[model samples]
Target: MTGKSQIADRIAARGASRSAAAAAVDAVLGEITSALAAGERVTLTGFGTFEAAGRAARTARNPRTGEALEVSATTVARFHPGATLRARVAGGSGEPLGAVPDLGSLQGLTASEPTPVETPVPAATSSVKAKSPGGATGKAAAAAKAKAKAKKADVKKRADAAKKADAKKRADAKKAQKKADAKKSSSKSKGKGKKK
Candidate 1:
């Protein structure tokens, strides 16, 4: 949660006035932002590199309604941390870096071992029957078979309806095209008659 103000405070601790430190921090950050906006990479030796990366257009889905959507391609800002910063964050035995302060706030930041939890296993019961390839016997299987048949019939009906609709649309289009051609031909004959 270390922000720009905290960074300026850290800088001010090294003898500079608070306003001067804030201005310096603001100037540096503004330059970095400007460079990135102009598609230039800004690299701070032991900190990170900032640049604009192009993203390709893609199709995405709406999670709520399961509807598909298209996402347009664009350029986005990206950051890549330098080796020293990576090593420090990973608790490597490297020399201390100057940008990041050795504060108590960062203490105990090392990864801790996860505690193991005991899960109870369910007791087996003899009353539950194992299923065969044909499934449960009697009424349940009959009901399942009937439901499956009904679902298949409904799917077939919808498919047939869609096919009929497509056929009708094509037929209408063909008829309209024929009428246009006939009209064009009639106009051409009328033009010849007028010339005579």
Candidate 2:
């Protein structure tokens, strides 16, 4: 298992665990950090570039005093991980070293490596149809009447519910405002008595 050391350590380990591995990792990370701190960029093959970028100075207001203050320019280190790293992170082939095979075109392949065939099932046909009382017109008229009745019932139910909810809300708000006014008047009377 690879420990939490730098890339240098992993490379130095060479499939063997030793103190030299940690030292190598530390040295490489220290060098990279030093370069970045000094405003230098580092590039790794198949990996992205690392560099220190300068942030522009800006004027910011102090929240406490509402006074404008100048913020000084600063440099921040940033890492752009390489394509191979990104692909690996994103659970891809990470094939920057070689071209990846076209798996999309080879889709639907089985483990036995046999070509699959598409078979269509015939649509079902029903011999007995529903018998209406009179004809299609009678059935449609009956459906329309039922639909209009349902709509009217639903509208009435909804209107009643909304009216009830609005009344309850208004009552609650009035009660809350009355309680607040009473509290405020009580506090004011106490303050006046203390003054006297």
Query: Which candidate gets the maximum TM-score versus the true structure?
Result: 1
| lDDT, model 1, position 11 | 54
Q: State model 2's lDDT.
A: 0.60
lDDT of 1 by residue, 83-135 (tens): 87897879864432344444333333222322122222233322222232122
lDDT of candidate 2 over 1-196, digit per residue (tens): 1122322233332432334444444445667777787788999877789999999999999999999999999998899999878878799652233322442322332224321222222232122111331222344455668999999999999999999999999999999999999999999999999999
Error of 2 at 146 (Å): 56
Cα RMSDs, all models: 24.3, 26.3
TM-score of each: 0.47, 0.38
- Looking at model 2, which ten-residue stretch has the lowest summed lDDT? 125-134
User: Candidate 2, 155: how far from true, in Å?
Assistant: 38
List candidate 2 segments past 4 Å from native.
Answer: 1-14, 61-69, 92-196
Alpha carbon lDDT at 79, candidate 1: 94
